[model samples]
Target: MNWRIETKKTALLLIDLQDKLLSVIENRERVVQKAVQIVKLAKLFSLPLYISEQVPEKLGTTCKEILEVAGDVPRLSKNTFSASPILPADIPKNILVCGIETHICVRQTVYDLRMRDKTPYVLGDAIGSRNQIDHQLGIEEMRQDRVLITSVEAIAWEMIEKAEGAFFKEFLSILK
Candidate 1:
């Protein structure tokens, strides 16, 4: 429930960013752009990054844009809507999540994270769905139920603290 993203203690949990899933989201390009930014940030901060594909055999692999930036992050392939079971028990306390079809995979994962007593921070701008109303409703329910909802810039700035030196400048330029 901490508002700030403690870089060393947080992990990025990307849910169902698979091919078929991304194709139907409302803002695929925009969500992918933000996810790429987070992938770069996670690497820069040395935070663990995990991705899941809901039945990769059926939905297809994660989109190339995200896969390209994610480096060697672990990928979970399963039929489950929630990616929790596949996640390692030793993951960081703060889990930053984003992905397509917010009402299903994303929503279930957050709920499971809560049940597991892990703190989940859902990235608002980085999540999308074919039905925008469902996406919004999913977010609202999670927020009301105590899951922390946030934006990439909010989490990144707190992790960065201030825009100083070349690294900050470089990171800031990535957002442009």
Candidate 2:
């Protein structure tokens, strides 16, 4: 199978990026920034975007920056740690995921996606945990499961595919 993230066949999934949880995560600012960047790319490419809030009432909604860039993308308010159940029916086969508490919500969501026969590419630099150990462990485990653990820049470049065109120039500006 082709492993590269084809713009048309992929969806961006942001999981449990709620304010309460994000506040305690390590490097919260970087995580949030990368997420915002990915959302912008999603909008530019018109790829389907989906977001999940573990428990909005208790955790609060997805952060302002993400929601602002995400525009009217569907946001799922779910109690389950794994977001697979509430993901929209029309979401693409390959999901690009990024969000908080890597060892828990993010990891579980990746596993569940694998079970559903969906390819989940977890954005390592855009996901975080309260501790670096948990974050690394989550990434390592996902890697062992054959999940693509990638970075925002890497995915952007892969999706862009070539160095020419107006969109390519815009993506370069975004990467800069």
Candidate 3:
């Protein structure tokens, strides 16, 4: 497990960020905004990306903002809280994770990924819960389990790794 994010070896996973779920998340707007930012980062850096929907028939698909920027990334439909089963076996071992219902789907997926020996860094700003307490505690619990907790900006800088470069310039443009 790498302590720092290596862009070539990492995959971005956005789980259960559906319309029905977002409608109740306390930080819905921020979550959507960060999700878009992360998706753009994935595109700019050419990182592999996956978006999981939890029973989309009832919950609805991933939000349009993310999908619009995500381009052709795989969108998985699953009944399980942990998206591990649906994910392709060949995906990168280092995962940047974000999505709705932090305590339920997001938390469970992080744990399941760890069990599979995959390193999952949960983006704090991109995930949400219906209640603030649940969101905070869920993050705390994941921290206790030794999962890396990060923000979208932190990971973006980590991947970029320097102040000067074409990638960094594009990253700045995306931030605007």
lDDT leader: 3
lDDT for 73 (candidate 2): 74
lDDT values of the candidates? 0.85, 0.89, 0.90
lDDT of 2: 0.89
Model 3 lDDT on a 0 to 1 scale: 0.90
Look at candidate 1 and give me any clashing residue pairs: none
In the predicted model 3, the residue pairs found to clash are none
Off by over 4 Å in 3: none
Q: What is candidate 3's lDDT per residue for 90-152, written digit by digit as tens?
A: 889899999978999899999888888889999999999999999999999999988889999
Better lDDT candidate (2, 3): 3
Candidate 3 contains a number of clashing pairs equal to: 0
Question: What TM-score number comes out for model 3?
Answer: 0.95
Give the TM-scores of the predictions, in the order they appear.
Answer: 0.94, 0.96, 0.95
Cα RMSDs, all models: 1.5, 1.1, 1.3
What is the lDDT for 85 in model 2?
Answer: 92
Per-residue CA lDDT of candidate 1, range 1-176, in tens?
A: 56667887799988888778788788888898899888888877788999988888777898899889897777888688888989999988889999967888888998998888888989989999898899899889888887878888888877887778988887787666
Per-residue accuracy of model 2 over 1-176 as CA lDDT, tens digit each = 67677889899999988889988999999999999999888887888889999889887899999888888777899999899999866678889999988999999999989888888989998999999999999999889878899999999878887788997888877777
